[model samples]
Target chain A: MKKIIKPFWSYDVEQTEDWLQEMAEQGYILKKLHRASRTFYFEQAAPQNLSYRISFDRNQGPVLASRFLENGWTIAAASGKWQILQNSKPANEIKAAPVRQGVITHNRNVSFVFFGLLFYLLGVLLANLSTLVSSWLQDGTVAVEPSPLWAITYLFLALTLGAIGLAIYSIVKIKKSNQAMLQKESGIAAAKWKSSQPTLEIPESSGRFVKKAKLGWMYAPDRLESWLEKMEQQGYQLHHVGTIGTVFYFVKGEPRRMSYHAEYMSTVESSYFSIYEDAGWLKIFESWSAMEKWVIWCREYKEGEEKPRIYSEGSSHLKRARRMAGLYTVLFLPLLFIYAVNANREFQEFINEGAALSLFGLLPAIAFVLFLSFIYRMWAYYIRLRKNYSVFHR
Target chain B: MNADKVMKKYIPMTETAFYILLSLTEPRHGYGIVKHVEEISGTRLHLGSGTVYGTLTKMQKDGVITVFADEERKTLYEMTDLGKQLILAEIGRLKELHRNAVKYEGDFL
Candidate 1:
């Protein structure tokens, strides 16, 4: 006996609550409902193409629709259709913003500093111990003769390398902080210029009239290419295009700019509408008007003598610097610890005679630099986060 | 792929359910079941590839479905005796529904 496994129907409809209510009346059980979009899954003998508005237990609104086929009801498509549902009746879609993973970021910051500081301290401690040993050996206080001076020198050299590694890391962190400030300032300037500008007027061509447009913020170049391809397949043409950091601009008869996050496309679209509402630029009756109107504005130039691409590239460099600095600090810490633990006895005697003062000073200096670098990384993260917030929020 | 022999326990079956079960009688995978079902159903159902996978997993958990051994990584399922019985009961219920539907005298059709 083949038992029929009931299919859960999912929908983005206008009256999700009412439909769910009717389904419940029909002995259908709700499976799971997404609080954000009011989209849900339900197990039932799928009803017709019925739409209803429904409220969840939390009183969040969702418009839902469902239907059944012989095979079973299932989601067919969740494209522009899903986002467009918010525009129709009960106003905006409500979903909480995901909590930012601050712990991981903080942990990375800590690890970078902790390891560098550890290495520097270890290296300095080893040099001190080796000097103390050399002095003791010189006085014949320790029984066995200290090893050769070269062994102590080798220990000092390892500690010196550890310190140098830390200094380099600290420098990288400060540089990243500086770079982030520069990028954020440049972004503000670009935003201002973009807002003050008028729409691009279509240039006259004697041969023919072309009206296709590409209007969006181009975040990723590769992803934008795919989106363009899809639009072209659907009969849209590109005239002029430009990218500025994560923002991309395309022009045809007019210009429009939209945010370009791959995963948050729906949120971007909704945000675009809200921006338009704020600007009072919405005209409801224009067919294909959605294609022409600008929701948010940002500057993009295809060709300029000195474009802001340098700032964007510089920002990427800063990110790399922070990651590299964190990694080197981690690597240097263990080596410094090992050197301190295994200093030569002969070298200790030499240090006891105060002959290795130059080497002793070098070890502590290196340790100090590593400690400085660790501090610099935390500053770097704070600056980066602040810069990002200013760019988006402002 | 022979539902008549593999699905004897679930005898009374809708053409759709029977064809789906028949395709699963062997170690036919989701795509395999879809292809077999399409072949026997004369391409009427044309179940989407996603739907086939979803259906097979659900059936397997209900014990009306069982996995068949194969070296290939693709998970293939077959109808169990219990699954056959459920299908039989469903078919009988559908037949009764059909009989009731036929006695209608109004122009509802």
Candidate 2:
């Protein structure tokens, strides 16, 4: 019997693994993992003890998959960059392995994206600060009445707050995972499987449009693919991606194993889709944000057919990473400059107020600290990529 | 490639790199190398797939190892002459360290 569980969001690979194992022990063996929707699908089976482990890798190619198989780890489910493996033996019985470089790369990539998102949210807040203050001066509150401006202000506040919270959550999760991996804890613990009755929930049948915003252009492709996949599994096929990528349009469809790939490009040409089409890929969604231009394509995974890759060569992969690093630098440097200018202005204004601090004055200081930390994190990521890829250049 | 330059470049190699290079003395695919490394290290060094694949990529790019053959989905790799020389150099360095430790062995007892 198929069962659906409530959606949960977590960046901690260990916690997610533990939860999945718990479900399995309760007699719900995970059939598929839907990370985008934070949902899991399970097939009822006789309660059996199973061990679950998670590995994060952006490039989960055939070679790595084969290697894991040879090591007696069966691929349970994969969502975006995360792969879940199961073996009958306890995880500790498995040899302790060094943390894969891919885990580090994944963590770094997530951090860089979170930094970009936080910066953008801060910029929006700062841009609206004067207007908000002026409105408050004129009327006692920022959002006074039913108007487009007030409505937009409220919407922006909600979205930005949500985005900031997600960014912080992701950062903390990445940090915790990194520490665990570094400590040689095999990246994640083996979850003890048990058997129990399956819990049920009604699946949404009708198509719906969800407004979602993701931070970091480079990191969104994997997430968007998984999200779209989850929606499709719920009988909602993604029909359109909104201009800003905040609104996703979906239509009802049967659940299918649809392969999605997000390619980064600053500009789109008809020739691009033509190439992928010739290789059996179909253009599904495209979005151009200030920080990134992504074209998402999907194809059905034919039985016994090799999975397609956007970049087959190692050199090409390195080049793409380098381009992303350059774009991140370009995007963040300007934001840093704007922050500097704003901080100076705020300092001068506060000085003119005879050094008395207000909540308004304190906001910029907190934002400045956040921006600095974000910059440092991005720099560390760039340095890591450079160090790792330096041998390729030679 | 110059042996001295190669040695200087890869002198203090990581244990993963050292074992990988040692395993490549015979042509082996990714999984083969991993199993070989585990056996030779007496199961002390369990090389994960990611480590092996990542090291193979870096080693191939650095000219220390070359793709010897492609067996369907698996790619077989063998150490280059420079790689062999670097391994010998690493052994020589290890031997000297071992000799120095031998002199201090009695102090520990």
Candidate 3:
């Protein structure tokens, strides 16, 4: 029997894994995850106890999946930026040595997501600043205006506040989880592999086209690849991807082994697609979102076919990281300056005019707080990339 | 680079890197190296596929390993002369450390 659970959205990796395990214990084995609809499909099984581990990566492919399979771990399901695996036995009992894969421990990936959110918040702040300036110039004073501006201002403020709260919550939660993984806590043991065991059979494919609407976030290539691969396993081939990658169109095809590579490029050249095509890669999807564009390519390899990489050199990998870090810095620095200057001006106006501290009056403080957080996150990301580059350079 | 320089550069190699380099003494594919490392270490060190693939790419770029052959989905790699030199230097360092430990064996007890 097939069952579909809808409207399940989980940002926390551990919670998602636990929820999937709970479902498995109840005889519902996860078959596929649909990010567009926030839905999970499960196939009925004999109700077995299983441990689920979620891992995050940006460039995961079939080689990684094959390693998991060789180590006796089955890829159960995948969703946004996460790969979910199920082991029939406990982690420790499976492998003598511990595997140090933790979704929360990926500092660089987490910081990238934080930076993306910061950019959005910065855009909102700038939009509000413009309106506030125009209003002050028209009224000849920084007084409350009776217009829809107040509504827009407050809405933007609320969003900024909400983003800050979510960022703090995520950082704290990930830190705690990383510590727990290091301590080998019962709740967060590192994922391990046991003896090879046959995975639960998935239901046969029903040849039908399905359209899914979902938003793809930054630093989430692994999640997208896994989701597409799962669909392929169920006899669905991604037909066409929407412009922003929010709507994915898939058609029925035979289940096969496929690999996907997601590369970020601001500009796409004809030669770029040609090179990949020459190497047996098919340009599957192109997505653009808020100053970031990603081109996803896929290739189906038979059991013995060698896997190809878009970036085969270590220097290329490091260069990509450096470029991304540079992009974040370039986008962040100007916004930081603008927000700082605006905050200072607002503070001075409040002092000179003896303005009452309203929500508008508190805007500077909110902006300053966000600025500090963005700096901290960017600094952390820089340090992480530097450390990784150092290792590779050696 | 001289042996001393190579030693200084790679003396404190990560366990993953050390095993990967050692496994490349013979031409082996990515999965083959993983299995070989597990066998040599007696299941003490389990290398993930992602880790192996990444390290191999780095090693290749560093001139420590070279692609010996590409068979469909698997690429076989072998150690280069520089890699061999570094491995030998590392072994010399390990031997000296062992000698020092043997000399002070009774101190801890």
List per-model TM-scores for chain B: 0.64, 0.88, 0.85
Sort the candidates on DockQ, descending order: 2, 3, 1
lDDT (10s digit) by residue, model 2, range A356-376: 667776776677676666555
TM-score of chain B of 2: 0.88
Candidate 3 C-alpha error for residue A146, in Å: 2.6
The Cα local distance difference test for each model comes to 0.40, 0.61, 0.62
Q: Which ranges of candidate 3 are over 4 A from the true structure?
A: A1-11, A63-67, A79-81, A90-93, A96-102, A105-108, A115-142, A183-394, B1-20, B23-109
Give the per-residue Cα lDDT of candidate 2 at A96.
Answer: 26
lDDT for each residue of candidate 3 in A164-215, tens digit (9 for 90 to 100): 7777676556555554443343121111111121232332244354788766
Q: For model 1, what is the C-alpha lDDT against the true structure? A: 0.40
* Candidate 2 segments exceeding 4 Å error: A2-10, A62-67, A96-101, A134-149, A185-394, B1-20, B23-57, B60-109
User: Of models 1 and 3, which has the larger DockQ?
Assistant: 3
Task: Return the lDDT, model 1, position B77.
Answer: 59
The TM-score measured for candidate 2 stands at 0.41
Model 2, span B35-54: residue lDDT tens: 78889999786664334555
Sort candidate 1 into its docking category.
incorrect
Worst 10 residues of 2 chain A by lDDT: A188-197
